[model samples]
Target: MSNRGRDTRTARSRWSLFGPIVAVGTALAVIPLWLDHSGVLMGVAVLGLAFACYAIGFNVIFGSTGQLFLCVGALAGIGGYGGAILADTVGLPVVVSILLATLVSCVTGGLLSLIAVYRSLGVIFTGIITLIFTLTFDALLLGLGSLTGGENGFLIKAGADTFLRKRIPPYYVMLALVVAFLLLHGLLRRSHVGWAWRALRDDELAAELAGIDVARYRVYGALVGAAMLGLAGATYAFTEGRVSPTTFGFAQVDVVVLVMLAFGGIGTLLGPVLGAATFTIVDEILIEFGQLRLVIYGALVLLLFLFLRRGVIPTARDFVAKRRLSQASAAPD
Candidate 1:
């Protein structure tokens, strides 16, 4: 095939891959605009979108690269608090603060990746290292009582004059972020760096032998994932108008994100969004269950893993494709 023909084929493949994702995202984006104007539903949707973005970032590292950086919540907290401090304390503009906060998260992620990847730590060890960071960061947030407001948490005054104070704006912002990250994930999946990451993920030793810079790609994954998580955190702070240790701690960060990614279809483009949406709705419904909520939720998630190990989206995709193939085979030529 000619180079042009190959390029055309690649372009078509890319379109085929992302077309459904884009269509679904568009439909979801219009929900808040045209659907019921209930504050409760709006709030749930906003939270779901924000976490969807966060889960996507987490998926980039753990799902795509097979490196478990479990401190997603901590990274997000850094962004949320960092943005708040910059905007409130230093009096920076909200946009600038958000950008700086994202940068900080990226740096933190890269540093963590350096420790995890450059050190050539095994998967379990990497998770342990990130878990330590998450715990330590939570402690740090509490210890910085004046800055983070400790258990009381700090209110975000920035963007007060803007639409961010309202639920709708934040919801739209989060939706936009989720869509952007999904697109970015798709692009990265087709890029050379993505190839390197996948190569490393499949077989690190073999990838290294093939001259792929395993450490560099790992760091790249960390940086990209961290940046997205940080952006989500900043949006969360803006939406809630507060930053608390609990919001970005272990429960919210590690467990929630992992569950979302796993349930949605790890490594798939639409999995994080689907997972985040599904669990967020579940959370809303189970909120009234109080302590038993966790039990019920855990049982459900366990069932999902037991039955559909690859996750709902990927498994469904496989089933559909297989059915189509069988149908084509049975069809007369």
Candidate 2:
């Protein structure tokens, strides 16, 4: 094919990939306007979007780079508590507090990467180290009761003074953040850095042999992912007007994020979003299932792994693409 024709084909292929995602996002954006003005529903929507943002960030290091970093919740907690403290205790402006909080989380992630890369840990080993960091961070949060409000949590009264005080505003803010993260993920996926991370994920030794700085790229993934998680954390603080240990604890971050990413299709740009939305909506509905909710949810996830392991989004995409190709092949000239 000619260069111009190949470029045109590539452009068309890119649009074909993202067209559905864009359509879905546009529909979701208008949902608030049509839905009943119920605070509870809106709260659920906001929470889902927040989790979506968190999952996208988590996907960066875990899914894209295959690092198995399990400290997403801790990183987010750093941002949440950092923002809460700066805004509430130090009496700083909300925006400034959030910015600083994001920076703190990013630095924390980078530091962790530095340590892990220094040890040259493998994927499973890296997960164990990050998990230990998560548990220790959780302990520290509880230990600093005076600062973090202990089990009761730290409330951000400044939330009321900001746009986050209202449900709709926060929902929109979160939706915007989710879109930004997705765009960033897409851009990175098409860049050299993203290719380096993918190479490292596939084979660290080979990547290094190919002259790619594995450590540097790993740190970059950690930095980018941690920054997004931190921003999500800041948004969570303002939306809920509080930060607590249980909020970003093991069950919330580790299990939930894994489930969402796995269910939505790890390493895919829109997987986290779809997974978050599906899981959140179903979870809210199943809240009345009492104790059996856990069993039912686990079973569903197990079945998904057994059957649609590539994740719903990726599986559907592949199916559609195949059908289109088959149809095109069958067409007469």
Residue 248 lDDT in candidate 1: 90
lDDT of each candidate versus the true structure: 0.88, 0.88
lDDT by residue for model 2 (1-333), tens? 555687788898789656756776797799899654798888888888989999999999888877788988999999999999999899998899999999999999888888888998877899999999999999999899999999899878986866787768888898889888888888898789889988987888899999999889888988999999999989888888888898889887778988999999999889899899999989999999999999999999889889988898889989999999999899955
TM-score of candidate 1 relative to the true fold: 0.95
Runs with alpha carbons beyond 4 Å of true place in candidate 2? 1-21, 324-333
Report the C-alpha lDDT of model 1 over 132-170, residue by residue, as the tens digit. Answer: 999999898889898889999998888877898786778
lDDT of 2 at 258: 88
Determine which window of 10 residues in candidate 1 has minimal summed lDDT.
Answer: 28-37
Model 2 global lDDT (CA atoms, 0 to 1): 0.88
In angstroms, how far off is 86's CA in candidate 1?
A: 0.8
lDDT of 1 at 158: 80
